[model samples]
Target: MSKLDEKVGKYIDAVKDTCGLEPDVDLLRKVTAACGPVIYQRDAETVASSDPDEMDRVKKNFLMKKLGLSESDKLDEGIEAAIETYGRSERTKYRAVFYYLLTKHFGKDAVYGS
Candidate 1:
């Protein structure tokens, strides 16, 4: 498997185990497509920001805008909420897990404290 596919595959399994999420291939494709633009902005912010703190705003804006969520203090909350919309979940705030998947897909330099 390609690196991205391998990572997302693990995420699919993780979500299923964590919260009974069962995403189909079509939805996964759409999400992977959306990740392109979001990751681009993330990389840009990483490169542009002298202050590591400022990049959080860029990350939040890209993630929320791509996922069609309202602005929030927490991008991960927005992402988790968006995920819940796709499938109901009893558990909340799986952001850490989600970020782990993203980091695996995109690599540590891009998604994890870049």
Candidate 2:
């Protein structure tokens, strides 16, 4: 299998063991691939920003705009809340939410290694 497939397979297996449900692998791959550009853009923005708050804002804007959730008041507000709660040292909550959204749309087997 390709590297993307291998990573997706591992994710699928983990999801299966945790959720006890099979998910669509093809959809997962598509969503994962779609997320790549967003991740890259976020990384670039983070590198460009010297201030942590500025970096967080850039990341939030990217997430809101790219995810087509710009109008989501709850998500927008929640992101800020999460950032405050988690502080600048880590972003586990945000990452978890991002992965959750990806898996929700693409299934557990979405290929992301490529």
Candidate 3:
């Protein structure tokens, strides 16, 4: 597999193992593609849930802009729900998997053409 495809596979495994959910493989791959090259970088590959700036970026960039969601408390709640589902104790919360959870959580699978 290509590197991106390899990463997507890993993210898929993470969702199944860490989040206890059977992810839509095609949707996860598309979400991971949407994430771009950040997935290739070690530090940027994972999300720091404790960082406010990162959380804001996720809300603004991923949730609102990419997913075409409006600003609301539900957005924040969705982030929290993804974080909670990913396990707060888990340090390496892969961006693809996290975004996949958020997409699934908000019923935005249509955004990824799921």
Count clashing residue pairs in model 2.
4
Global lDDT scores for all candidate models: 0.43, 0.44, 0.93
lDDT per residue as tens, model 1, 27-57: 4444454455443343431222233453355
Give the best candidate by lDDT. Answer: 3
Give the distance in Å from residue 59's predicted Cα in candidate 2 to where it truly belongs.
Answer: 7.2
lDDT of 2 by residue, 1-114 (tens): 875565456545544544344655665455445545443344431222235675465446544454444445555454454344334344322232334333354233323332
Judging by TM-score, tell me the better candidate of 2 and 3.
3
The candidate with the higher TM-score, 1 or 2, is 2
Model 3 per-residue lDDT tens digits across residues 40-90: 999999999999999999999999899999999999999999999999999
Candidate numbers, best TM-score first, in rank order:
3, 2, 1
Q: Which stretches of candidate 2 lie over 4 Å from their true place?
A: 37-62, 71-73, 76-114
Worst 10 residues of 2 by lDDT: 41-50
Instruction: Give the 10-residue window scoring lowest on summed lDDT in candidate 1.
Output: 42-51
